[model samples]
Target: MKIDLFITCLNDALFPRTGVAMTRLLRRLGHEVRFNDAQTCCGQMHFNTGYQKEALGLIRKFVADFRDAEAVVAPSGSCVAFVRDLYPKAAEWAGDEELLREVRLIGERTWELSEFLIKVLGVEDVGASYPHRVTYHPTCHAARLLRVGDAPLRLLRNVRGLHLVELPAGDQCCGFGGTFSVKNPETSTAMLADKVHNVLSTGAEVCTAGDNSCLMHIGGGLARLQSGTGVVHLAEILASVETVNPAAVVEPARFSAEGLA
Candidate 1:
């Protein structure tokens, strides 16, 4: 099947390797992956920040970009969640029946990376091998919004030489709600402190999550504390093979709040 990648704005700008790794993983599984340069943000930031009117334009653009694809796969759970859960409401609020129909059609085909890999592709093991102790942080959208329960963990479990450990308070938000981190700095920092503590407690060398946004937030705090823990996206881990080590698959750069901002 021909799959269109809806590389979210954050992944496009901040974490380009995540998108590349996702495409590599899909192609390795024998699926043709296409990237539409016309694709832009899914309007998740605007919609979450109470700018619905401005978000409508992006929502329409997203539909136009991937409307023809047999399947639309995104690496970011939050962006996919916005398209699947909010676009229909945005269309209704605009009173555009045509847009609403288009939104429903496109939203139905949009799937989070793990969801598509397990449910549609029906493959738990992508023939990945990563010799490391890894702990997963279930991002809010992937856990709560997408409800992709155990899909990511199942894939991780199948990786060769991968030790998957349960994260304490794995379901808690990493305090990176896009604008939420900016508007309420103190509260965000406090929550981030707790998340960092939990990640350190895992005793894992690497921390992995479905969303880079959360990884950015959690990874940034870990960096500040001078922790040895590294953060990687799930796609990057799953894309690893015996021929290509996970470390060499993507850049070894650690995320920082300065870079993200």
Candidate 2:
């Protein structure tokens, strides 16, 4: 299968390894993965923040960029949800019937990483091995919007040597709604506090989620409190092979943020 990697803005900027891991994992599974440099933001931020006009432009660009892709897979569930669930609505808001038709066609072919692997590819246990105690957090967009129930958990469960613990109150939001965290700091903080406490209670060394944005929010709180619980993306965990220690998989210094510039 030829898959086009739609590295979300967060993954492209702050979590390049996630994209790299996804690409490697897919290629290991015998799929050809391609990256289009012409790709840009899915306009999730703009559309969710009332900048529909700006978002509309990006949506059109997204359609133009990936319309011919055999299949589009993104590691970020939130961004994928925005593309599959919200793109048609944005097109409707513009009253562009042709855009709406294109959006629907593209949306159907696009999928989040876990779903693409499990649902589209029909394969779990991509031969990944990660020896670590971890818990999975179901991000809001992936859970509530995309309803990718148990797909990520299923993948995690199959990882060799990985101890997958059930996260307490795992479905609760991590308090990062992109702009929501910035606009409602106090509320987001309180919600994050509850999330952090639940994560700590699990005694898992790492918290994993499909969305890097949520992990970034949870990781910040965990780090500030010196909780020692690191957050990693599902792709990174799934891409781990037996030779590589899980601890060394995600090194902040290895991938420079300056590369996003």
Q: What's the alpha carbon RMSD for model 2?
A: 2.9
Number of clashing pairs per prediction, in order: 0, 0
lDDT of 1 by residue, 1-261 (tens): 999888788887778778777877998999988877767778988888889999999988888888888999988889888888989999999999999999999988999999999999999999999889899999998888889999999999999989998999988888989999999989999999999999999889889999999999998999888887889899999998863333333444422222212
Compared with the true structure, all predictions reach lDDT values of 0.87, 0.87
Q: How do the residues 2-109 of candidate 2 rate in per-residue lDDT, one tens digit apiece?
A: 898898777776788888888879988998888887788899889888899999989999999998999999998889999989999998989999999999999999
Pairs in clash, predicted candidate 2: none
Q: Please report the candidate that would top TM-score against the real structure.
A: 2
Backbone-clash count (model 1): 0
Residue 65 Cα positional deviation in candidate 2, in Å, after optimal superposition: 0.6
TM-score of candidate 1 against the unseen true structure: 0.93
Candidate 2 ranges beyond 4 A from true positions = 243-261
